[model samples]
Target chain A: MIEWLAARAGWPARWLLALLALIMLAGVVILAASIGEMPIPLSVTLASITNGLGITDLPLDRIQQGIVWQYRMSRALMAASCGAGLALCGTILQALLRNALAEPYVLGISAGASTGAVTVLLLGLGGGLIGMPMGAFLGALAAFALVILLAAGARSSTTRVILAGVAAAQLFNALTAWVVSTSANAEQSRSIMFWLLGSLGGVRWPDVGLAASIVILGGLICLCFARTLDAFAFGEDAAAALGVAVAPVRLILLTVTALITATMVSIVGAVGFVGLVIPHAARFLIGPGHLRLLPASVLIGANFMVLADILSRIIVPQQVLPIGVVTALFGAPAFALILYRARPST
Target chain B: MSLEGHELRWMKHQTPIVDDVTLTVQPHETLGLLGPNGSGKSSLLQLLASLRTPDTGRVRLGDMPLRHQSRRRIARRLALVEQHATTEADLCVEEVVQLGRTPHRGPLRPWQPEDERIIRQVLERVGLAGMRRRRWHTLSGGERQRVQLARAMAQQPEVLLLDEPTNHLDIQHQLDLLALIRRLALTSVIALHDLNLAAMFCDRLIVMHRGQLVAEGTPATVLTPALIHEVYGVTAVVERSPHHGRLQVHYLPDLPPA
Candidate 1:
């Protein structure tokens, strides 16, 4: 349906699609905030949010209002931001690396960030001088640098890059496991394992602020390079021939991806599959033009994550499954579908 | 505008791929580069395009050093259609051609009437006007090459560099493409394999053997039985075709090496 509209209408169709996606995202976010441990009505949730923002005052139960305003709202917003950021990274990586499977989780960025966060938690690296996000950022860079180094000689080969990423993910995951097993007590290990599985239970307003700001900033920077990324459709040499400053643009964009991935990993642990699958879905719906693909991925990813979070909360009897578990459960089958669809015609 | 490469040398893993190659393409001239396999024609074309920095020499665009100009600035005046250039992205033909306009447009600039006009004109010129919306993966090899040519034409470059663009093309397209290049009269350096096509289309010809320029002149002067044997290790009889009034080469079976 969207393809027909976009093809028929051109410029106006993009705006309409974007508007539709934004509305869908808003609806899912509201749905997420309303359906939780304590069921709150949609009207009360809206009133509570508006009241919290000093936009409107309405009578509401204090506990329900507090749950919606303080806990569910922040968690929902953070999920949206995290989803947008991850999907954006996936889109950029797939373009630059020219591989459909390239994403933060698959490329080892998330695993590296998990290692860094675990180091901060158990080993007390930096003596609390550096925060978890900073540590994760450094580790993400380290893993990325390692992958690039290993993949340097075969830089044009996408398969070699993915292999190098597999190597980095194994090495960092081992490091994370070693730290936790060696240093943590039973209770600490349990908590660390839970965090590693991606829990959004503890996210608050501050986390939401950080995630939203980084995602917005990163999305904007990526938008500015949309045309440059398009030039890379053929390859690096092709991009250079088309007047893209390949090296600097690559460095800046990779750094931004690492930063965004690290922030999300540090906050909510390594949520897999969204980054890998959302971009493909967005491309399928909107085509491969980065100008539209980037925004479409962001909005779709936001909605997908919020919906995933909602499912994570409600799927069990009085228990919350990890967000990563829910995402992977859905994303794995979707990934298979994408791969099946992508098979070359005989 | 003239494109000149001065003493260009590029090495990969300590082995020279393009060695001390110096050449020039005059304005409105189609210069054909001929070579056997592994003769460094592709590398030399890249060096001339400034896509790869020469190890020890410089390329000049017009009178200015190519290294001094921004990539965007160079792209506006020069374009390269790389051999076997393709993408995994599911881009339609028109979208792929629009990529040619990158150097001419900016991020904030909306698509203009001129840009659309150029795209349409190039598509029409390349004979893919009706297939604008065709997905790339659905196209045949020959169609893909023509689409790439259309893209290069959309760049509006004064100096065009193409590497074996006729590789996958049919015989008709090969002739048509060369004739089109001739008609455009743009400063072009084309790496071609067919000696007859080079002789028929190019104003001048240069031949490479083992990363060195071994022959350079008009095709009539540069192409000879001795040069062909020495460079390509092939026995051939070179004669002017009466039908086309151009040199045509007839190859003989290889004599057993003694």
Candidate 2:
């Protein structure tokens, strides 16, 4: 039925469909914020946001202000930014690897980030706010560099690239596990476990801003190379024949995606599924043109994350599930459906 | 507009694929390369297309060394159509053709009217105008080859390199595609397995045996019965086609033994 509608609507109508999805995403965010503890009204939440932005004179109580501004707003922003970043990374990775199964985690970016965060937490690198995230960023960069080295050495075939990613991911996972096992403190182990599963529970305004900047910058960079990404979808040799400087472009894209994935991992822990699910969802809406697919993936990813975060909050009474669990729960079934539907035709 | 390779030697895993071969294609000329399977026709074409770097030789486009130019710069002047169209993702016919404009387009500018016009003209030239929105996978083998041709044409290149373009095409479509290539005034280097089609379409023929160029000239000069027997180990009779005034080959099948 959707295919029938899509066929008649043309390309312009697809854009309209994407816009409608975006509106629905915004509605989900607002609804999510209103459903939490203390039951803040929609008008009160809107007024608080407006007041925070210095747009109106609608005054709110301090606790109400804290609820809207300090807690829910940052949480929502984190959800959206992480979602968008993961999805964008997934879209780029899929093109780069030329495999639909390629995602940020599959390439060891998440494992690398988690290892970094775990190292900092176990070793007690810094007694301040900046220690864990910085460690994760460096770790992510290291993993990215190692994967590039392996893939480049093997001449960058799709099979070799995936193998390199899998090898690096396993190495990092083993190292992270060792670190957690040897650590004497139970608190450190618990924290590491929480991070590996992912959460947006403790997001502050600064973390929100940082995540947003990384996502925005990374997203813009990816979009700027959308044509190159399109070239990659045809495989490396075809892209090279089309004049893409394959190795250098792949390196730069991998680095940029690594940076964005690290920033997200630092802020919200290692959220899965958003990177894997959102691109497929976007492809379902728009065709495989990277020009449309990248931006649409970002929007849909953000919406998916926000929706997942809302589900995490509402699934239990006064107890929020880790965001990663919710994403896995929703994403796995959807992924299965896509595979099942795609299998017959393929 | 001219392509020249000097003492070209290429190796794959230390096994020579193009051994000390020298060749040239003049502007507005079609040069057909013919060889038995594994005789390195495609490898030589890859060298000319700059898809592979020769181990110890130089390739020149006009007077400029091919290695010195950026890929985009070279792509603007020369385009290559590989044997198979194997993309991981599906694209419509028009979208695939539009990829030809990659070299001509600036990074910041969106698709302009001229790009669209050229793409449309090329698609029409290839007789694929009606399949503009059809997914590439939905197209038949012949249609896919035409779409690939349209993509190469959209490049508006001075030189075109085709590797076994008629591999999966029907005989009629193969003839039609070769005819289209002949009509285009661009310098073209085509690797073909069909000697008859190559003889009819190409202005010059280069024959390779065991990764070495054994003969080079007009088809009538190079495609002797002796050369065919020596290179392809097939006994064949070369005769004139009454319908087209072209040379045609009829191979003698081996007889069954008691």
Candidate 3:
């Protein structure tokens, strides 16, 4: 079915799929906004969002409007942005690194963020809420730089890059563990652990604005390199021969991936597996052209994350699970399935 | 455009792989690069293609130094078909061919009808029109090489650099592909192990031995038995073919000291 549409419609089929994905994304985001402890209706949720946008401005109940707009809408939007950004990062990394296993988490960007956030939280490295993200960003950059340094030595193959990432991830994770053990009291430890597992409970409007803008801007920038990424299919030398400045393109894309991953990691507290799995899912659905793959991964990832957020809220009786745990529960099995399916057929 | 290399030298681990090689190919001339294994034929092609910058020299395309030109601009004029260019991406033959259009199109520019026409023409030319949708992994090694050639042809380059492009092709495909490349009449540098094919197709031949250009001449002049013995460690009788009037290399089995 996918091949037929792609063949028949040529380039337009991707846009058509994008439109379908957009509608699906909207539906899920609305559904996410509707479900919660307060239980607002779908119509009210839609109205509240439009009212918040100052589009329709329909008269609604004060408390209901505030809850829907202020809490649920922000959370859901943040989730979508996080998902979209992480998926974009994954797609770019996989293409540039030429590895199916390449992702922000695998590259240790998320682990670096976790270590940085833990440092700020427990070691009092930074002052407040703003400090945490900045520290995480710096840490993420540090880890990425270290990986690049290690990988850029003699015979800088893709496998070497992945190995460097593993080393960085392990080092930062150990740092996080050390900080938590040395400084955190029991109460602080519990909250820190929850945050590390990933929580949307504390997100608000500013975070929504920040995440959405960053993701959209990042996605647009990446979209512009879609052809360049396609040039990399046969590897770096082929891309260079195809007129792509391989070094500059790889640097720009990897930096963009790092920034997006770090920003989302700071905002949502290290949500795992979405970046690692969503691009593969998107590739499986659509073909491997980055033009379609980028947007498809973004839309599917957005929808997946919003639904996961909904599940996280309602999975237990009167208790919200960490969003990361919910994603890993589904992501791990899907990851395994992808590995099995992608295994070499003799 | 004419392609020239001026004292091109590339070193790996302090040892020169392409040792101060210099040559030039006029526009539309097919130059053959010949060498035994590890003799730097592929390295010379890579340097000429600007995929690797020479350690101590420069390559030029027409009037401009290659390094002075942007990669995209170079790609617009020169296309390379590397030996073992494979991908893990699940792409079809058509999709792989379409990537050849990367240097021609920009991100925001819509795919032109001209681009599609070119791609279709190249695929048909490579005799893979029926297999446009065939997955890349399913194709045999020869088929992959043909697909890669089709891709390079789609670039519509003025200069083509191929590194052992006929490696896995059958005899028929080898002949046909060489004929097609010769017919294209682009300034081309093809690294080849098959001495007869190089003699049949290339306008000029340059033989490399131990990272040095040992001989550069017409195939009749260069494919001498002594040269073949010194470079390839084989005793080969080089003769003009009665059928096509090109040089043919016939190797004799090594016998114990007689």
Candidate 4:
């Protein structure tokens, strides 16, 4: 495997690996879509997606088509893109911040998004999930501003940034709890808590469109800065000495990752662990080079999320588990094991 | 071309750390910045390297001010090896060395064969010829220092600034590193704690006392017993060594400077 990734083969091999990942993701998507109640046939599921995508014309009943394309397919795509965006954010954050444990939400975007989402849900600000993402976007940007402002006094060190993020997370968590406890009764608060845990139960075409644009744009921007991010793998001084405009570039990349991560949280309600663990998992398979690790993390995260969502839907039969719970359940242990093994044992 | 500082002053928490330091190094000369801990040697070196901007003074490379040159331009011409620099993650020696070529490449430019050749040559020059794939955390303290030196050399710099590069090295590696720095075809400013080593390795030595350049000249003239006692707060005897015909300093045990 190392020989295959060696520079003797280089970019062509990377592209080939990416192509294989893409093919596997497509296979997973079709398979995951066909796993719901009523058991849509794989052939019909493929036909429905291809037809919905306008690739081909096929005979299909209206209800089955709706179930396959409108419901299952849309949810799967949202999971894929959200996963990609979150994983990409995590990868960039880990490198730029010079910390392996730095996750997508390390800058407090998810906490802020949760605050915005809870506010909208309790007070009926946007009346539904529609305005929730808007609130999340605004709150994410605001919380990020606060983190930067709080950390600015500390000389922009990584420890300071993470600490500021933790502080912001606590502040926003308080606000979320206050809103939910005050405005929402027991039934409404239960739904609010479930949403906070993250759910993809009601995903539709608009959610996919909204998330895909940012994920693709953000991923492209990250790709352009892959070499700069690689420079950061050493440290800030080394990166600056290598001609990276340290101050501005770090601020821009942090904001860029926040933008993508905020959108993902709004869509998926703060899906956990994909952002924290998938990047490290990808790094283990491929070495720490951002050029390869960035793309590998995206593909692997997408696949992992799609599978998790499928399991969430099918686990208890008519009682869907929140996707966040599923990820946290599996992701936390996997991450701990990886961390234990990766570090030198002194 | 010369690297010069004009009235360089730096302050931390309302206290001056580098106090009005003005110095210059001729092209291809080895100038040692010798001072004790917190005596402003690192601060002054950082000011000269363009890594840290002074509060009241400016650094000039040739006719241009340090700020006038773009960071890429400065990086191409100047390289600094920090005293305690370490990678946050495990990277192979080759990967670490290849990062030195970053200033020369950009978004569109790919890594070239010439960069590869330079990396190979520097690795061999540093006596790490077959250790390209060695992990950073696995290397000894001395090997890490040599890796840093190789990285600086790969920058193709016109001027190099090193802060305590030999701090953790064995005696042999320390001597070898200084000799290599002297032989390199560039101007160098190295900070050293060992006055005798600095005297032997440096073409000229600048002694700092209380954030001031107390003396500057050839090692033989600058490293007098009185100056060493004054700056470093230790009674020392300075004499010419017959073996190398340069100034050698021997500190009196438990004796304080008067």
For model 2, the stretches where C-alpha displacement exceeds 4 angstroms are A1-25, A56-58, A124-131, A145-167, A340-346, B237-243
True contacts kept of each: 0.76, 0.55, 0.82, 0.48
> What's the DockQ for every one of the candidates?
0.63, 0.51, 0.61, 0.52
User: Which model, 1 or 4, shows the larger DockQ?
Assistant: 1
Task: Point to the candidate with the largest lDDT.
Answer: 1
What are the per-model C-alpha RMSD values against the true structure? 2.0, 3.0, 2.6, 2.9
lDDT of 4 by residue, A158-251 (tens): 6677788888888888898899999999998887788778889788899899999999998888898888888886577778777787777887
Residue B178 shift from truth in candidate 2, angstroms: 1.3
Of 2 and 3, the candidate ranking higher by TM-score: 3
User: What TM-score fits each model?
Assistant: 0.97, 0.91, 0.94, 0.94
lDDT (C-alpha) at residue A215 in model 4: 90
- Scoring only the A-chain of each prediction against the true A-chain gives TM-scores of 0.97, 0.89, 0.92, 0.90
> For residues A1-346, what per-residue lDDT tens digits would candidate 2 score against the true structure?
5445444687787777677777887787777666686889998888877777689877678898788878888889789889989999999988887766567787787889888888887767666565877888888988887877888742456666668888988999998999899983787677668768888888899999999998898888888888888876566777777888787888789888888888888888878777877898778767788888998899888888998888898899898889999998987887677556542222
lDDT of 1 by residue, B1-258 (tens): 999999999999999999999998899999999999999999999899898899999999998799867999999889999888768799899999999999998975888999999999999988899999999989987788888888888889999999998897889989988887787789999999999999999999999999999999999999999999999888999999999999999988856887
Which residue pairs clash within candidate 1?
none
Q: What DockQ number belongs to candidate 4?
A: 0.52
Error of 2 at B158 (Å): 1.4
Query: TM-score for the second chain in candidate 3?
Result: 0.96
Residue-wise C-alpha lDDT for candidate 1, range A1-80, written one tens digit per residue: 87777667777778988999999988898899899878888999999989888888888899988899899999999999
Please give the CA lDDT of all the candidate structures. Answer: 0.90, 0.84, 0.87, 0.83
Two-chain DockQ for model 2: 0.51
How far in Å is the alpha carbon of B162 misplaced in model 2?
0.4
Model 4 CA deviation exceeding 4 Å by range: A1-10, A120-131, A145-164, A338-346, B255-258
lDDT string for model 3 (A282-302, tens) is 888878988888988999889
Among all windows of 10 consecutive residues in model 4 chain B, the one with the lowest summed lDDT is: B82-91
